[model samples]
Target: MHVTWGRNIGTTVQSEEDLYFSANSENWFDMSSLGAFDTYTSDNDWVSVEKMVPPVETDDMITTRDVSKLCEDISSLYLNEKFSDVILVLDGEKLHAHKAILARCEYLEALINDGSQHLQQSEIAITDVSPEAFKKLLKFIYTVSTITITSNVGLIVEVLELARQYCFKDLENATIQTLKSALNLKNICSTLNIANLYDLSDLKQACHTFVDQNALEIVTGDGFTDLSQKSVIQLLERDTLLVPEIEIFKSVSKCKLNDDDDNLVIGSVRLSWLTVEDIVSTVWPSKLVEDEKLLGAIVEIVEVKAKTSVCRAKKCMKNNHNWRKIDL
Candidate 1:
């Protein structure tokens, strides 16, 4: 019998009566045990067999059993003054750190390098990030223990800001994922504002989806009007925002922080979807839109609705006539 095998696989030929093969330097298998073939070829004839073996596993397998312990060991070094090469001052407190690990962050690397091969000083000051937030950042850098990141929305937002500010991509991604999972009505607006301000597209899109799903409660809820003009416009532009045009108009009217914002937000609302009375009473009083534009929009909307009503009635009447004409 002849055997064809995949590249890099070992093969050895022996007596055809009971063939044995070893795919590696050690383990060997009998052909009979593998049940690879039912019939044997004659001495004058040749049969072909092909086999491929996957890479072998050994006793010395790579394991992460010590990874967590290693992380914990490194975490103990965090904020410890011993063997510390640098100090970060923030939130009226000093943080101990190693320059080698701090270089993992682009912003911190720049600060440490300071246009030279090494740090100009052992101390760096940061005023924007709070001590609790900076400590969380350091914890993640040392241990990568995401579980310790607080579930509180406010703290998570602070962590997200520090992560972004320091250009810690892993910490930033992890924080955004946490925020995405933590999104709710009470905090969506504030979280969305941060997402928009920093142009964090993934987190921004998550916020948009959450808002779209909880459109009614979110739009009518407190803090809705405090959204940035751009965020308001994004919400108004969605066709799936299942809220009455009147309520949306009310929200948009309240969103007016300035003339430009007012015009943009008002334009985004589908005024034609509102009733004539709604436009006159609610929208007209606000005067967000000009008299001529609002009047024209209302007139056009009323005409379209009237035409639609007449067509529907005519269709019903025709269907009735057909029913009556048919023999029962």
Candidate 2:
């Protein structure tokens, strides 16, 4: 998810996967992220949860500016002691809040209505979510605006997890965009894996492209050498790898030599492209036995392959042979 917002106007995005949006004139953005406001109608009235955000479009779509002024007005009342209806004890610090806004958090709303004596007291305490994280959440809830992400790059993943956990779809997308922007050489591999896990398709492709472009570096990088089996398997399956297959073979060999578990991932590699010696040394050493017979057949095919004086050792001049002659 990538969000590019213009000043009080449009938002451009280059999404990698699914973005579910409800279509209607009244509903334009999901308010659940910010106290579950439902939709932003011209009257600022509430609607059913079903009437949520429509697809992110630049033309005729509303920006956060719609209710942004309203949020600022509401925020003014947040810190006023006389106007505050609820108190939040977060990580030992007390903060003023409101029932209407807090109700957006379905879990908190349920707890408040569960007849707990504490709810009757208009006070709630939380120890799990950090104050810093909660503060950012509250800021977004009250501002209906972007939470500064550049300075908080290190915490992007954490914020994303928090948003997803709390069903804050818009916030989750914002955090993902931050994560994508913060991707770097050191974290690219793990980021790629995480993106794949969370289906952040745009970030995943960016990571994949990084791997392809920096194949040699990544293959030799500390964390990448220990890359997970799934990532390794996926990398081996690509035809656009920047390095030669031989180099990949060496890299994978080094990886398996370090951990036998990597041997399983190596099974998926197309061994037919490897040289006869590589098949014997690397593929044969591993327990990918299924390739043995095929390798033997390939060897036989290469051996019986007609090679004249001019074409003997020069691979550039090698001609195709009827591979069907090789026994399975």
Cα lDDT, all candidates: 0.72, 0.60
Off by over 4 Å in 2: 1-68, 75-82, 150-154, 199-203, 253-261, 276-328
Tens digits of per-residue lDDT, candidate 2, 1-328, equal: 2222212223322221122344343444432344432233344342222322345566766668966876678767654565678888887788887777766666557756767466577778866775777777766665545656464454666666677777887777777766667766787777777777777787778788777656667866776666666678777776555454545656676663334565565665445555566556665675544655656646764775523111001112235631111111
TM-score for all predictions? Answer: 0.73, 0.59
Best by TM-score: 1
What does candidate 1's lDDT look like per residue over 117-147, in tens digits? 3467777887766778888888888778673
**How displaced is residue 127 in candidate 2, in Å?**
3.1
Say which candidate scores most in lDDT: 1
